[model samples]
Target: MTLQLLNRATALWRAFIVLALLAGTSIEAVTQDNRPLLVAARKKRTQTKKSRATPPKKKEKAPEKAPEKPLEEKAVDLTELDQHGTNTSESYNRLHATQPSSTPNFRTYFDLAFSYRPGDQPVSFENFHSAFLLEYTPMAGLTFMVGLAPPTVLPLYYELDWQITDRLSLRLGRIWIPFDQINPHNTFGGFINTSLLRAASQEAFLPDVWADLGAAAKYDIIRDNDLQVESHVYVVNGFGQGGTDPKGESSSYPDFSLPVARQDNNDDKSIGLRVHGLYRNTVGLGLSFFTGGYNNQGTTNARITMLGADFQAYIAALTFRAGYAYMAVDLPLGTSRQFYTRGGLYTELTLRATDKWKLGILGGVQQNDNNVSDQNDRTIWGGKIEYLINHMMIVSLQYFKDLRQAPGKTNFDVALLRYSLTL
Candidate 1:
């Protein structure tokens, strides 16, 4: 019975060991699964605590945009005027430094006049001349200008003008003495108007381009009213009878009274006066007076006085230009006993038939009180028409008749065709 009890106890011990092993294995499996679960739970709790401790990041606001500008409208000014002061430069670059020369600004003109005279004529071609003008503005209110007509390369004038104020300007060097509108190679009327030929009386007593080494001052009234006023005063070396022109040629007979004086024979100089005005933007009037000693030969001394009046007005397509010049010479013919009076008159009218076509009529008379030469008391009348082929080309035809009526006079009935080109 005791042996039986021991075997039974061993069997029971073995069952107990298997049962304990199974319980241990089951516990290990449950611990392995529960270990992963507990670790995952602890990690989730740690993340939750970390999230609670951190603060939220703030958002950045974008910047606002600027407002847009309005579009500008372009325009054209009719009376293109800069009311700025004279000394103030018109260009910004000129004010800073010298003007840079790009393509230079220049003007050149060519004119050819072919004339046909019915009677005996010395030459076939009446006139051949070329004119050129070049101007450069180096800085503000400064100008250097040169004008030339060829056959003689000598410049017509080399003038320098300085603008001191808006209404005042000073000129030095050689300059055209301002007298009548035509004397300076300057035109009195619009394009397609005024005769291409100058009046005989106009050319009788002055150089076509009457320029001399002189000093001049010009003053403008700068008035608000349309009644504009300008005054010119100049002192020059004056002219000598039978002197030479800029072309270095002797003066012709009829042109003896009008000569350019390069050297003065006496200490006395010439004084010129001009008063010009305009009204209603259409009517213009001018008064001119010039006095100078004509000769200083000691035996023959003469004082010349020139009084001139000019008027121009435009009514629609019709334009009228008239001038009267009375020149008086107090000549000591024979030891202060006698003097001669010479005068001249000319008038012109033009009608614009079309925008590019012009028709004109002109009349002129010259009186020589001495009555010694056949050219004394001459009358001239003419008609002219010009068609502007283009802005740069013009074709003009003029017909004129000379009335001398003297016994040995050689009158002329002439026709002229002219081609004028401006570049």
Candidate 2:
């Protein structure tokens, strides 16, 4: 019985050892399978903590800006005005700073002159040649200009100028007739238009600042730094009878009253030619001729002819100018007189006292009709003092005394205070 009990105990011990070994193998297999999953969980936890520690970036704001101001236009250069205070084509183009190009450019300007005449009938204020000018350049060598006076639809002057070549030019429209030095070239020559002898004498025969509807050809015979010579030829509608006859009849006789006739009263047209030369900008000479029929009957040959010559000399601050004009009228069929003739002469001298002061004196004489010695002949003397207020403004005081008919007669006289301005 003791031997059987001992064998049973040994069998129980073997069973216990087999069970312990099986348990150890199962734990090792399970650890190998779950190793990758445990490592991935630890990395995810680290990334979450880093994201929480950092902050987002902020945006920046921009600063405010200031408002801009408007730009102003440039004014004309006043130092370029000639001795006559005139704005010639050369001076105008230079002061305006224009160039010839295919591109278009447009500009506008204003000029005015007004005077207080204390010697008129009941002393009055007068508005002279105030103008609003428009200039246009559409292409190289071409330009168009128009001048207007407000409230009057009529254009004061208008023209198209074409520069065909360096020395040749052509012009059309109602342009200033190239009849004399002052007529075609003078624009805004200070406040004293009456200060020049040419202005006083030419008004009796030719229109002051005479301009007419016409086409002109101008050629520069010689142009250089020290001298310039030019010639002009043109044809235009001549003068007409001053007024319609009282009986509403058209007379075949000539009209001595030469009125500006833009529209032709007759078929005949006027022709004019002028040649001018300037030396060193100090001395100038001009010669002009004009002829046309003034009778209402185009078939008749009643005509008027005029010849003019002018001289200018500038020495230091002093300037001298003189002019002579002669006119002849041819009578129509069956007239008592064969021809009527008239002539006039004038002289002017100007001294520049200072950069801002100028003094001038002028004298002129006119014979209405030399054929018939009547009291219509007249003489004139004038003096002017000009003060330049600035580059764009001028003030002038002038006096004119008329010596008419007889030497001892008390003739009319005028005193004017004028202002000239440009804008």
Best lDDT among the predictions, by candidate number? 2
lDDT by residue (tens digit), candidate 1, 236-261: 76776553222222221123333333
| Model 2: per-residue Cα lDDT over 350-370, one tens digit each | 887977788888777766466
Model 1 steric clash total: 0
Cα TM-score per model: 0.66, 0.67
Which segments of candidate 2 are over 4 A away from where they belong?
Answer: 1-97, 100-120, 150-152, 184-204, 243-261, 372-376, 406-411
Candidate 1 Cα outliers beyond 4 Å, as residue runs: 1-104, 120-123, 183-203, 243-261, 297-301, 333-337, 369-373
| lDDT (Cα atoms) of all candidates against the true structure | 0.60, 0.62
List, in order, the clash count of every candidate structure. 0, 0
